[model samples]
Target: MHSRKIYTNTKAIAWVTIGTALFSLIFASGKFADGSASPLQILFLRYIGGLATLLLVVLVRRERLSAYRSPKPLSHFIRAVFGASGGGALIYASANMPIVDATALGLLYVVFVIPLGVLVLKEQLSSQHFGAIAICCAGAAIVMASRGAFTEFHMAYVFPAGIAVLGAALLAVEGLMIKMLSHSDRTMTVLLYVNAFGILLMAGPAAMQWVPLSFESAISFILLGPIAVTAQYCIVQGYRLASLSIVGPVDYTWLIFAGLIGFMFFGEKPTLGVAAGSAIIAIGGIMLAIIKPPAGEHESTSSA
Candidate 1:
């Protein structure tokens, strides 16, 4: 039983890791599209891409339109709003600031997840795990603050940084919504609604900032659909496979993925503060993953 549990967790972690790595690419793409497209435009194209891919899959599989129906339409709408706004905020923030810092701010969602997990999902895990989460958030804040030194003297950058924080909180709420919706809807169904709503919510804003894309840029924008869909799919699957307490910490991997991509592709590098912060985060994550509950108590683990 123990071995089987380990395998299940390992698999869940693997899926989520791939999803987050791919998610980092989305962040990078936001930066890549910065000068070429507004955040709304990018979000619109991304949702269109995701919706298109999902439609193709449904057609290819001969899926019934009924597969898209959900008992919780309002829930789906609310989640979509949160997801779209949160995503749009991140895209804008990513464009204005370093992708790594934006990514770090996004990582703050995991911090909010613990409390929400307890309140909404009723998740029970080790106190150590909760502390570990705090550690990771502190570290991410340090990383963000360190990179923030680049703008330490620049006052214009402050608002975008604040937007990033808002985005993270919204996303944390969206994550819990996903958990709630998963109880009543299929993953594909949930995704279909979110993407469809994403398009609708972003349409007006996107149209306001519309610009014709070059051939190369058009191709890249279209590709955003598949990447976003797949990444979201994996993340949803991870939640289905493990408790949020387990999956939330792993979400911190976004910083590592973002930092590397920022350095390799954007010629950005982290300062010493980033290194120190990341080390603390690493310690916390390790503790979260490996530590056991005290005697006679086990974590409240659930599959969904």
Candidate 2:
């Protein structure tokens, strides 16, 4: 009984950590957005920060870089390209739009993944999945339309929304790749390579549009990587102690956190429409989470 209770508690912590990390991501992105940093510059700082954290880990563990090898070099390259593209789009979107709005738009990826899985990865979608997708999309539409009432529609919204879809698709691909590679690769090895390649790919473009950083911006940029790493570690450790199903819904806490931070930091107020739409989106996401795919049905690569 004690062990079970401990396990439950750990899982709770893990979910909280995941949600908190996501919340941190919103704030970090918002900071970049408010600064009006170029998309390339934002990407550069994010990748550099992430890479530096991984390098520090490598050093502390005394792990040799050569120890990490990919069985599918081409796949890694492709994944990196897709990942970088998504990152670039996100940076652009985040910088130009409200943080909560960007996040809401990004959530549409969950809806896109449903169809992409069936078409691209040949995964079967059950009726429940379809229903969930429909519900989620409805919620997303509500959110998007709500935004239109307050602000004039711009081409920029399309960019972020499109990137969100692409990012979701890329993430789905990455998951499949990870599963295939896990046959021979350690998790850390795959992560290291992904980050390394991602950094290399973004560096040149980011440098082309670089801006001088204020002392505060420099500090924020530097801290971003370490915070992300710590948050990820906490999440991993938390999962080890708890059931995923129980912890999964807790991840939505980031939305609340994002809303709060967005309002406080940026003075972005949530209108009734935004609130109603967000609630619907949240409900759809939760439904998707709770509903299971049917037996004998292969889950799609894009479902994540």
CA lDDT of 163 in candidate 2?
66
Q: By lDDT, who's the top model here?
A: 1
Q: Which candidate is the best by TM-score?
A: 1
Local distance difference test scores for all models: 0.77, 0.56
**Residue-pair clashes per candidate, as listed?**
2, 0
> Where is model 1 more than 4 Å wrong at Cα?
91-105, 149-162, 269-283, 291-304
Scored against the true structure, residue 12 in model 1 reaches a CA lDDT of: 62
Predict model 2's lDDT versus the native: 0.56
In candidate 1, what are the lDDT values of residues 145-192, reduced to their tens digit? 777634543577689989998999999999888767765677788889
How well is each residue in 1-304 modelled by candidate 2, as lDDT tens digits? Answer: 4444544544444445464655467355646466556556665676667778887777888978776666777777776787677656655666666644666555544444345445654655567556655654665566556656225446767766666556655654543444344334555555566667877897898788877878777667656666555554454343333323223333444554555565777787967766775677566555544554344533211100
